[model samples]
Target: MKAENPKASAEVVWANNNTDDASLRLWREQSRQLLLSEAKARGLQSTSPCLCGSGDRLRDCCLRPLR
Candidate 1:
């Protein structure tokens, strides 16, 4: 399968390699925070377009609340 965001992947790798110990520590913490944010987002209501350019509100469309 093709990568969705090759640029982002490259940037992440560069950031990881160039970061100092303290910066890397902060990056790890931020990554953890992002993971938690995404987990919480899985349940939160979304009434906007999708990442695929589909102009559908998630809660009203594909990612709608479980019935």
Candidate 2:
């Protein structure tokens, strides 16, 4: 899926049909963290395009809401 859409979320791409695999699960978590870090580094404005390149505003797109 990454080849088709490099910005696709790893969780959505790497799902194991609701079953879990240790390596894949760890990889998904790590990928999420990495993306989150990159997003923080961008520190984009609400009007700016999302870092994911989905054409949505940064605040309206992918990253998890920080608690």
Candidate 3:
């Protein structure tokens, strides 16, 4: 199973009224945009990934080479 959202632990509260595909899709797209914006704001290169448990900082010692 996929891991739950650490930031959004309350599932029912967030997905209560919306019980349709369109609502779910909109939520997903908004979530994606939020994540991307947050990543960009943190100066994390979109190409490289942070894997050392230090979030996505580029110099966090777990920065992998960009593909």
Point to the candidate with the largest TM-score. 2
Q: Pick the candidate with the highest lDDT.
A: 2
Q: 1-67, model 2: which lDDT tens digit per residue?
A: 2335665545454534555677666766786677667766888555678786779876566544421
In model 1, what are the clashing residue pairs, if there are any?
A: none
Model 2 residue 47 CA deviation in Å? 10
C-alpha RMSD of each candidate structure in angstroms: 9.6, 5.4, 8.0
**Whole-structure CA lDDT of model 2:** 0.61
Off by over 4 Å in 2: 1-20, 45-49, 57-67
Point out the worst 10-residue segment of candidate 3 by lDDT: 58-67
Q: Which ten residues in a row have the lowest lDDT in candidate 1?
A: 58-67
Q: Which pairs clash (backbone N, Cα, C closer than 3 Å) in model 2?
A: none
Let me know the TM-score candidate 2 reaches against the reference structure: 0.47
Q: For candidate 3, lDDT tens digit of each residue in 1-67?
A: 2227465444552346646767766766675566556667876664546433555654343222220
**lDDT, residue 45, candidate 1:** 38
For candidate 1, give the lDDT.
Answer: 0.50
Candidate 2 local Cα displacement, residue 24, angstroms: 1.2
Error of 3 at 28 (Å): 0.4
Q: Write the per-residue lDDT of candidate 1 for residues 1-67, one digit (tens) a residue.
A: 2335664333442245556877766766675555446535775335555433457764454333221
